[model samples]
Target: MTNKTFCVVCKRDDASVIDMQPHLVRCLQCGAYEIMAIEYLQMTNQEQDPLLSAWIRNRTEEQASPPLLTSSTWISLRASLRIPNLREKQAALMKAFARRSMFPGTVGRYNPVADFPLAWAANEGELRFLKQDLIARQLLDNEYTMGGSFLITAKGWDYLDSIPAGGVFSDQVFVAMSFSDTMRTAWTSAIIPAVRQAGYTPYRVDAAPHIDRIDHKIMVEIKASRFLIADVTEQRAGVYFEAGYALGQELPVIWAVREDDLKNVHFDTRQYAHIVWKNERELEKGIYETIVAVIGRGKSH
Candidate 1:
């Protein structure tokens, strides 16, 4: 075996450096402070890496079974990983593992942009930071060599399990619609009331005072909402972008379009089931049913 220092968390050897005289090293990639082999061995005969050993023991108990891909627990776990910080990238990496492990015959490497579009790094430095944060948190296993993939540990799964699926903003529903007078009126008179009946608070951008950074406000709302309702009646580019962003975050999105404008819905989004309505009443009814089905009954107020 090659003698090298690696993060006890994200086993990558590249970013770790000797921190003390003996048996102590810190991984800059994932921010893991670990005891070296000699000290680790002296402390416990169970294994050189206690964290890895526990994970192995757990896996062996279950016959090395793969993660449950279809369980709600798994869905929530994956969705919760999309944090706003470097943890988002780390979660995406773990999600990639869960996804790959689900399909037996599938073979390919993880592509940050393709698999983790929401948390894709802008540059190598950002990617490095993300990996480092994951390692430091002990959520990811370290790689022993360059270009090696890291694995999620038992602690990682435990951490994910502790995160609530819907979180605090689970009852907030964001509306992405045209900013026309007719649309605004429909939202206030019809959509808002229907959303209220369905137990979710409907939020529209226009409700806020206009600011120079409107897009930033929209993004913040999108992140804060449990789901999004995108009205593509006018084929607004912004609505499409908002919906795409929600999808990237693994948030549920309800697509809506006027019956007359249905033909103009973007081809890329046309495949998804959309609520086609002729009037405000029809839109309200359709949206209400969709919301209940997607998110279940909202918290009783």
Candidate 2:
């Protein structure tokens, strides 16, 4: 059997033999260069290779555009440009550009643990603090509290970078958030899930509570949230009021609406691009872009 070579970066199989090195092959499609072995398992695991990450960065360029769907040659040209330290710098630049492009969007590479490094808790006290925070936020939920032993919800996980341990967690609580209800049924369902997916927990204030309360908890919560979202369905009064309140608080609010509804939307509102969605897929994609914008803003600041 012939040795199979694959580009570790793009994860493609289109490779070419190199004249200089008999054992090494190049991904002609995506510019991923590598060496392989005849036995399937013998190829060095790219992730495990200490130098591979750095090498990938050195081998790839910053301006290397995203692969075009139509061209295999374009696919092969995407060099793995992410060197560890260099990758951070690249991320920062990308973040800065993203910040300028939009507000309150997702940032970084979208790590599942929301940026948790491997083997995060080496000591007991640090682990204990994480548990306390999770409980305080009601993320772990009392039903499953394991005496400072449990997992965190997405909201809880976002705070990991804020943890004082100088790890990925930061100390910032809910700096900003977005909310909207005057949306198409499909879009309404998509927005919240997308917000959560972006790693920001958006609280829906659909029903107003009793006007009198010790903390004006609902409004206060909105105030504390760093941003807001309002879906204006052909000028719903409630949506306008809430959006106005967030704007008054100087919170970064994003408006979303259907295409037909835009005709009746106010000129002032029109000036600011209301995130529009024709369908659920578009709504999710919009939300992801918004998340990137939010993350980008955070990084730049």
Candidate 3:
């Protein structure tokens, strides 16, 4: 009889007498999608090598389910913020949050940045918890302190900059969204027609071309275009990279994602204003709305 072991996710080690093959486990504790024997060995031996230890830690954290903010902790922080001195301390902590270096023995007090530890220690655990939360949210740097004031990290600042005024988007719009293979084909076919109908020349950049010599031409064409229409399905890395390039150039770019894949999008991309659709009707409606909201305001691409 073949030896059998339980899967980490299922936690069932018993091998059926009829079928004794080893099975992978899925660990609910960590929300790991699949836990193979090889992965288990890697995890167990991560500490043997310093490089592997760091790599494993990063991978594990990345794959682990997101942590939820504790209600009690949130309430405590909110109440503490109401205190006059604590309010100032919280402000100081926020200002210092993004700095990469810290002075020991300082935090909320004036000139506290001179002694980082003092400021951190003075806040007790509440400030520490709040700081950690900010780091997790990408609102602050994990290891940063400046002369007792907290600063937003570059990433945090970029995120803040991405938000349009009054939450009313004006630079980007969704011109198309499709999910099924049929829908995708139809949307692709309609793109040129739709843009033309909108009184704009239909300049296109085929984002999903096979790796070939034509890739250069595609890029050149995109660069020459006055506006961008990005299709973000299957999470194509190239599509996302190109979309970002257009955005950086201050071009008006429309973001369209498949409705079924909305939950699978990365946090950075999902946070941005976007349109999602699953069918042709939804796509048309979404595009019209985006046109009226972002393109109609005389915002130049």
- Counting clashing residue pairs in each candidate, in order, gives 13, 30, 31
lDDT (10s digit) by residue, model 1, range 132-192: 6776777665552114344565676676555433223246788999988768766877789
**Candidate 3's error at 57, in angstroms?**
55
Q: Whose TM-score is greatest here? A: 1
lDDT of each: 0.59, 0.43, 0.44
Best candidate, lDDT = 1
Instruction: Show model 2 residue runs off by greater than 4 Å.
Output: 1-184, 207-218, 295-301
Residue 143, model 1, lDDT: 59
lDDT of 1: 0.59
- lDDT tens digits by residue: candidate 2, 14-52: 544443332345442233343333322333233322233
Candidate 1 residue-wise lDDT at 70: 22
Ranking the candidates on lDDT from highest down gives 1, 3, 2
Q: What is the TM-score of each candidate against the true structure?
A: 0.48, 0.37, 0.35
